[model samples]
Target: MESFPTELGVLTCLMLLAASLWIPYIVGVNTAPAGSLPADAPDGFIRIPNPALHRPWVQRAWRAHLNLLEQGIPFAILVLLVDRVDGFTALTYWTAIAFFWLRVAHAIGYITGFARLPLRPLIFLGGWLCCLIMGYAVFAARMV
Candidate 1:
């Protein structure tokens, strides 16, 4: 059996994390009060109120998911770029793992309201920095 690369494993974990972040928001929406037609509805149209507004946790969950998307996309791209260029290095490997865990912490903190003020932003910054480090590794590797 062939062993998978560590970075690839981290990438898979990150993707799974993104996939699961929507659960809380969806559950919150389903349990919230029923919605109604919009004020500007012209016919038999109906629109649900923004689910995020139904609860603070739901709102945080929604925002956390959004933040992941914003950060995850670039991280994914950079990871792939590194892989494509055979740019795997100690720095990239460690940073990839760090990025995945940081995202998990960020999501949990946001959804549960555990991390606040500077803490959440700092977690986000860590993930962003991981992406930058991976990107730089890719660039440096390609220059060789």
Candidate 2:
């Protein structure tokens, strides 16, 4: 087993993922109407009205969510490997948390569509920083 930092980092990443996915579910549920939807909903209970195809935020949110899911699996693998190796550090824990925050912020900002262009880039960079930091932690832990 690794130190407490690694354990905490793993849990943080998991929670972040949960939050990331949860937001979409919450949005769908809350946005959906009572009488608007069917009582005995069929296969696809919720039929979402696609926000707007041309908008960047609409595309960005969808893309970012998928990207998060994509990278998330690898993060899990790295964390498990770290635990198996019984290794990790402060930087690792913080980096994982930072990545999660960045992802969430990016999703929120982009999905809301208020902040455009430069602000979007800044948020995007936040997510990138998260990836870079987490990647470094995983590599550093492996070398230990």
Candidate 3:
């Protein structure tokens, strides 16, 4: 059976990739009006230049996406480990959801150039904590 966390994680990655086009699309739309641009006009109507366009912001976005993608492996591992121990529970769902959503927040932060704030670090630490919990859970299960 497919793992829910891993599946959602894939969707998350797709969201990141799809989101990248939005800026460019906005740029294109900005060139148009009422959903259509004049034939002679160049595309630039809806697109605002992202501060995230810089090397640092772009790298941040990519790194965050990769980080989330890396987490996908562990997501599967968690489920596999869970099966070897207890079945899925509400807490498991919450934890995984929190992790996935935080990475998404990180993506948003990076894309919007908000990753520099304390909020970014907070969200990051949340993801790390979720991973740590899963690690502890696996180890604790083996011990039990």
Candidate 4:
């Protein structure tokens, strides 16, 4: 009956919802004219031309979602480790918040073409740093 950090729970839900956010774009791209698919297309296939390959915004959203998943795995592990060892410290809590917000920002930026604003990379790096901080906190807690 051990309690998990609230931030971790919230972030987990956000990550799952973020993954689903790409569905609309995927559906839009895959919804095609009747008989327009290539002859090679499998019968009853839902997707025709790969959305990411054909649409820039869809590509951006797909990549952003993938990036979130990539980062989320490590973040989840570290968050759990930290919770098991030391519960949530001020540093861990704030870092988790920062990471979650940055991820949201990154997704929005990518989807709306704001990622080209020169701040997107910085936002991504910020999220990475948050993960690094959480990792260090977990390590430090374990050493005590």
Task: State every prediction's TM-score relative to the real structure.
Answer: 0.86, 0.57, 0.54, 0.79
Better of 1 and 4 by TM-score: 1
lDDT of 4 by residue, 13-130 (tens): 7668666867746754565556655557666555543653345776676677777888877887888888778757888888888888888888888777888757988998898898
Q: In candidate 4, residue 135 scores what lDDT?
A: 88
- TM value for model 3: 0.54
**Regions more than 4 Å wrong, model 3:** 1-56, 70-72, 140-144
Q: Which should have the higher lDDT, number 1 or number 2?
A: 1
For 86-118, candidate 3 gives per-residue lDDT tens digits of 544556666766776777677787656777778
Ranking by lDDT: 1, 4, 2, 3
Error of 2 at 41 (Å): 17
- Winner of 3 and 4 under lDDT: 4
Worst lDDT run of 10 residues, candidate 3, spans 45-54
Candidate 2 TM-score, true structure as reference: 0.57
Model 4 per-residue lDDT at 141: 85
**Ranking 2 against 4 by lDDT, winner:** 4
Best-to-worst ranking by TM-score: 1, 4, 2, 3
Best-performing candidate as measured by lDDT:
1
Q: Write the per-residue lDDT of candidate 2 for residues 3-52, one digit (tens) a residue.
A: 36654655566656645664564465446556755555565544453433
